[model samples]
Target: MDTIIIEGGSTRLKGQVTIEGAKNAVLPLLAATILPQEGKTLLRNVPILSDVFTMNNVVKGLNIALEFNQEKKEILVDATGDILDEAPYEYVSQMRASIVVLGPILARQGHAKVSMPGGCSIGSRPIDLHLKGLELMGAKISQVGGDITATAKKLKGANIYMDFPSVGATQNLMMAATLADGVTVIENAAREPEIVDLAVLLNKMGADVKGAGTETLIITGVERLHGAEHDVVQDRIEAGTFMIAAAMTSGDVLIKDAIWEHNRPLLAKLTEMGVEATEEADGIRIKSDLTKLKPVTVKTLPHPGFPTDMQAQFTALMAVVNGESTMIETVFENRFQHLEEMRRMGLHSEILRDTAIIHGGQDLQGAPVMSTDLRASAALILTGMVAKGQTKVTKLNHLDRGYYQFHEKLKALGAKIERVSEVEHV
Candidate 1:
C-alpha cells in the first residue's frame, strides 16, 4: 500500500503544465490494434499510466507482440499472426477496460472468451448493452465460471439500438461491426471524442465507418484491416483536473497539449463561475483570484456535454466556494463515494439521490482520507490542496492507475506533496 501526504501552501501557484494523451481514447484504440494485418500498428503520444500498462498486459496475454518505448512514449503492437482469443479473469478483474478485447478478438478470430468484469468506484456498469448488441450482430454469448464465451460462425450486420449511450458498449460494437457480413447501423450511440478517435484509426485501417461522433453510426463490412499509425488526443479529464487545482489554489496555470474543443463545456462553466480562462491555439490558461468562487450547478451527460469523470474534481472545487453548488451525476449512480471522505476533511455536503448539494465557504482542515476509485483519488488530492493543514490520502494505487506523475506534477506547481510506502501487516 502507498499513501500521499500533502502540506498546505498558502501561496498561489503560477506555472505551466503539459497534459498527456487521452487514457479513454488510448485504451480502446489499443484494443482495436488486434485487427491489424500487416506491419506494426504504432501509437504515439501515449500516456504513462497504470491503466495503459494493464491494457498492454491484456494485449500481451493474447500473444500479440508489443514494443513500448517509455522515453519516446510510443507503443508498437504487432497482431499480424494468430493470437489467443481468451482474456482471463486475472487481467480483466483489474480494470474494466479489459473487456474491450472481446470486440477485436471476436472480429478477428470469430470467437472470444473473456472474464466477467469486476466492480469499480462508480455504479454498476453492466455489459448487458454490449452483449445485447453483439447478439444482434449474430454472436452467441454465454457465461460459465465467470467467463463470457462469444462465438459466431459468421457475423452479419443488423440494425442495433442501444438502450443507453454507453461509451464502452458503443466502441465494442463498432469494432465488432467492422468485420460483419453487411452494413451495420448503431442508433443512439455514444458521441465521445474518444469514439471519434477510434473511428479515425479504423478508417485509416480500411474500415468504412461514417457518422462516428454522432448519434447514428454506419459501418460497411470490409475484407480485412491493415496496420496504421495514430496519435492519441489530449486527456480532457487531466486538463480539467489541473484547472480545478488552479482554482482551488487561487493560482494561474497554463495547460499545454489540451484540446479546447473537447473541453468547451467545462471551460464555459469555469468562466461562468468567474474563473479567468483563455483559450489559445496551443492550450488553455486558467487564473483564479483569491476571492471566493461563485457556486454553479453541473450535470454529467454524454460527450459534447459535461463528462462524469470530472464530477468528483469539480465537487472538490465546490467545497471552498462562496455559495451552494449542486452536482448531478447522471451517468453513474454511486459516484458520490468521495463525498463522505470529503466530509471528513471538514467540508459540508449532502447527497440527495444522485445529486450532491455542497455548502461551501468552510475552512477545511486536513484529515486522513481513503480513496475509493480513480477519480475520487484525484478529488481527495484536490481537497488536500486547499485544506488548512497536512492531509494524508491512502489507496494511492487507484490514483496511479489513471494520472501520470500526479504528485510530481503538483510539486512542479509548488505543491508540498510526497509519496511514502506503507508497511505491510503480517
Candidate 2:
C-alpha cells in the first residue's frame, strides 16, 4: 500500500502550479475515437492518470490502433480498422467510464456487449438513463451474465428527454446519435464544458451537432465520421482543489492557465471566505491573509453551480474555518465517508440525511486516514497540510485515478509532503 505522509503546522504553500487536462472529458473523447471509420484522431494535452491508462486499454481492446505519447501529452488513434463489438469484463470492471464506449461501438458495429461497469463507492450511479435513451433511439437493450448488450441494425433518431441531466448519458447518446440515420434531439441534456468540447470534436469529424452547452442538443446523423484533432479542456476540479489549498494556508499562489469562468462558483465562495482571487492574462492568482477563515454554507449541484466533485475538498476547508459551516451533498449519497476518516484527525461534524454540519475552529491533529474516493484523496491531503503533526493518508489508488503528479505538484508549491510505500512509511 502507498501512503502520502504530510508534516503539517506552519507550512504555507506558494508558487505557481500547472493544471492538468480534465479526466472526465478525456474518457468520453477516447470512446468517441471508435466512431471515426477513417483517418487517425489526434488528441493533445491528455493528462497522464491511471484512469487514462484504463480507458486507453479499453480502446485498444476494441482492435483500434492507438498510441499514447506521454512526453508530448498527445494520443494518436488510428481507428480506421475493424472495431470489436465487445468490451471485456476485465477492462470495464475497473472503470465505470468505459461503459461510454457501448454507444460508439453500437453506432459503428451495430452491436455492443459491455460488462457491468464499476468505479468509486461514492453512491449508486445507475445506467438506467443511458439504457432508456438508447432504447428511445431504437436500440434494443438486454442484460445477461453481468453484461449489458445493445443491438441496432440501423439506428434511427428520436426526441429523448432525460429525467436527470447525466453527463455520461448525454455523452454516450450524443456519440451514438452521431452516426444514426436521422436527427437526434436530447432534451434536458448535460451542459458541461466537456459536453461542448465533445460537440466540437464530433463536428470536426463530420457530425452536425448543435446547441451544446445548453439543455437541448440537436445532432444529425452522418453516413460515417472521420478522425479529427482536438485539445482536452482544463480540469476545473483540480484547479479548485489547489485554490482551496492556497486560501487555507494563507499563502499567495497562482494557478497557471486556469480558466476563471469554469471556476466562477468556487471563486465566489472563496471571496465570501475573505480570500482574494484575481483573474489575470496568464491565469488565476489566489491570495489569503486571514489567520482564521470565515465559515460558509455550500450546496453541490450540476455544472454552472458548485461542482459535486469539489464538495469534499471544500468540506476539508470548512472544518478549519471559524464558526459553523454546512455542506449539503445532493449528487452522491455516500460521498461523506471522508468525514469519518477526518474524525480520526480531530474534526467535529454531524451528518444528517444529505447534509453535514461542521463546527469549525477546532484544533485538527494529524492522524492516519484512508481515502474514500478520488476527490476525497485530495481532500485528506489538504487537511494534512494544516494539521498539527504528521498525517498519513493511504488508499492512494483512488488519487492516481484522477490527479497527475499531485504530491509532486504540492511539494513544488512548498508542501511538506512525501509519497512512500507502507513499509517505508512504517
Candidate 3:
C-alpha cells in the first residue's frame, strides 16, 4: 500500500500548476470511440489516471483496437473492426464509468451486455436512468445473473426525460442517440462542461447534437459516424481542488489554462471566503492573504450551480475558517463520510442528515487517515497540508482515480508532501 505523508502547518504554497484533461469528459470520449464505424479517432490532452486506464481496458476488451501514447497524452482508437457486444465483469467491474460503453456497443451491434459497474463508495449511483432512457429508444433491457443487457434490432429516437440531471445518464443516452433513427431529445439533461465536450466530439464525428450545456439535448441520428480528432476539456474538478488548496493555505498559485466560466461557482464561493481569484489571459490565479477565512454556507447542485464534486474539499476549508460554516450535500447521501474522518484530525462538525454544520477555527493535528472516496482523498490531503505535524493518508488507490501527480504538483508548489510505500516509510 502507498501513503502520502504531509508536513502541515504554515506552509505557503506559491507557484503555477498546469492541470490535465477532464477525467469525466475523457471517459465518455473513450467510450464514444466505439460510435465511429471507420477510421481512427484521436483524443488529445487525455489525462493519464487510473480510471482512464480502467476505461481504456474496458474499451480494448470489447475487441476495439486502441493505442495510448502517454508521452503525448493522446489516445488513438480504431473501433472499425469487429466489436464485441459483451463487456465482461473483469474490466467493467473495476470502474463505474465503464457503464458508458454500454450505449455505444448497443448502437453499433444492436446489443450490449455489460456487468454491473463498481466505483467509489460515496453513494449508490444507480444506472436505472441509463436503462430507462435506452428503453425509451426501443431497447429491451434485462438482467441476467450479474450482467445487464440491452438489445434492439434498430434503435429509434424517442423523447426521454431525466428525473435528475445525472451526467452519466446524459452521456450514455446522448452517445446512444448518435446512430439512432430520427431525432432524440433529452429533457432535464446534464449541463456540465464535460457534457458539452462530449457533444462537441459527437458533432465532429458527424452527429447532430445540440443544446449541450443546457437543460435539453437534441441528437439527430446519422447513417454512420467516421473518426475525428478532438481535444479534451480542462478538468474543472482538479482545477477547483488546486484553487481550494491555494485558498486554504493563504497561498498564491496560478492554474494554467483553467477556464473561468466552468469554475464560476467555486470561484464565487472562494470570493465569499475572502479569497481573491483573478481571471488572467493564460489561466486563473488564486491569491489569498487572509489569516482566517470567512465561513460561508455551501449547497451542492447541478451545473450553473455549486457542484457536488467540490463539496468535500470545501468542507475541509470550512473546518478551519473564521466562523461556523454549513455544508449541505444534496447530491450523494453518504458523502459526509469524510467529515467523520476529519473528526479524527481535530475537526468539529455536526452532521444532521444530509447537512453538516462545521465549527471553524479549530486547531487540527495531523494523524493517520483513510480516504473515503476519490475526492475525499484529495480533501484529506488538503486538510493535512494545513494541520500540525505529519499526516499520513492511506488508500491512495482512490486518489489515483481522479487527480494526476497530485503530490508532485503540490510539492512543486512548496507543499511538504511525499508519496511512499508502507515498507519504505517504515
Candidate 4:
C-alpha cells in the first residue's frame, strides 16, 4: 500500500502553486472528441492524471486514436470513426467520468453500450439524470446486468428540465444535444465553470450552444463538427484546497493561475474567518495571521454557491479553528467518510445525516489514517499538517486519480510530506 507521511505540529505552506488544467473539464472535453469526424481535436493544458489515462483508454476502445504528449501537457485525439458504441467494463470501471462518453458515442454511432462506471466511493451517484436527459433527446435507454445501452436513430432536440443541477448530467446532455436535430433547451442546468468550458469547446467544434454558466442552456443541432483547438480551464477545486490550507496554517501563499471569480464563495468564507486573500497578477494571494480563528457555518450548494468539492477540505480547515462550525453537505451523502479518518488525527466532530458539527481549537495527536476518496485524501493530508507528531495516510490510489504530483507541490511550499510505496513496521 502506498502511504503519504507527514511530520506535523508546526508547519506552514508558503509559496506559489501553479495549478494544472481541471480534471472535471478535461474529461468532458475528451468525450467531445466524438463530435468531430475530420482532423484531430487538439487539447492543451490537460492534466496528466490517472483518470485521464482511464478516459483515454475508454475512448481508444471505441476506435478513437489518441496520442498523449505528456511532455507538453497536450493530447491529440482522432475520433473520426465512432465505430464502436460499446464501452467495456475494464475501462469504464476505472473512472466514473467515463459515463460522459455515452452521450457523444450515442450521438455519433446512434448506439452505445457502456458498463456502469465505478470510481471513488464518495456516494451513490446515480446516472438516472443523465439517462433521463438523453431520453428526452431521443435516446432509447435500457439497462441489463449493470450494462446500460442507449440507442437513437437520429436524435431530435427537445425541451428538458433537470431535477438537480448535476454537472455530469449537464456535460453529457450538452454533448448529445450538439448533434440533435432541433433546438434543445436545458432548464435548471449546471452553472459550473466546467460546464461553460465544455460549451466553449462545443461551440468551437461547430455546436450552437448558449447560456453556459447559467441555469438555462440552449443548444441547436449542427450538421457536422470539425476539429478545433482548445485550452482546458484551471482547476478551481485545487486552488481552493491550497487557499484553505494556507489559511489554516497561518501562512502566506499565492495560488497562481487561479481565477478569483470562480471561487468567490470560498474566498468570502475565508475572509469572514479572518484570512486575507488579495487578487494579484493572474492569481490569488492568501495570508492568515497566527491567531485564534473565527468559526463560520457553511452549506454546500450548486455553482455561485459554495462548491461541494471544497467541502471536505473545508471541514479539515474547521477542525483547528477557534470555535464550533457546522457544515451541511447537500450534494453527496457519503462525503463525510473522511471525518472518520480525521478522528485518528484527533478531529472532533459529530455527524448527523448530511450535517457535521465540528469542535475546533484543540491540539490533535497524529495517528495512521486512511483516505476514502479523491478530495478526502487531500483533506486527510491537510489535517495531518496541523496534528502533533507524525501522521501516515494510506490508500492513496484515490489521490492519484485526480491530483497530479500533489505531494511534490506541497513539498515546494515547505510542508514535510512524502509519498512512499513501502511501510516499515516497528
Top lDDT prediction, candidate number: 3
TM for candidate 4 is: 0.98
For residues 135-170, what per-residue lDDT tens digits would candidate 3 score against the true structure? 999999999998999999889999999999999999
lDDT of 1 by residue, 286-356 (tens): 99974757999999998878999999999998887889999999999999999999999898988989899
> In candidate 1, how many Å is residue 225 off?
0.5
Candidate 4 regions off by >4 Å?
423-426
lDDT by residue for model 2 over 309-332, one digit each (tens)? 999999988888888999999988
lDDT of each: 0.89, 0.93, 0.94, 0.91
lDDT of 1: 0.89
- Note the residue pairs that clash in candidate 3: none
Which regions of candidate 3 fall more than 4 Å away from where they truly are? Answer: none
lDDT per residue as tens, model 4, 1-426: 788999988989898999999999999999998779877899999999999999989888888799999999999988876468898689999888999999998998899999999998879999999999999887899999999999999899989999999999999999999998999999999999999999999999999999999999999998889899999999999999999889888889999999999999999999988899999987999999747579999999999899999999999889989789999999999999999989877788999999999998878888999988999999999988989999999888889888899999988998998888774522
Write down the worst ten-residue block by lDDT for model 4.
417-426
Using Cα atoms with residue i matched to residue i, what is each candidate's TM-score against the true structure?
Answer: 0.97, 0.99, 0.99, 0.98
TM-score of 3: 0.99
Query: Model 1 — TM-score against the truth?
Result: 0.97
Give the poorly placed runs of model 2, Cα more than 4 Å off: none
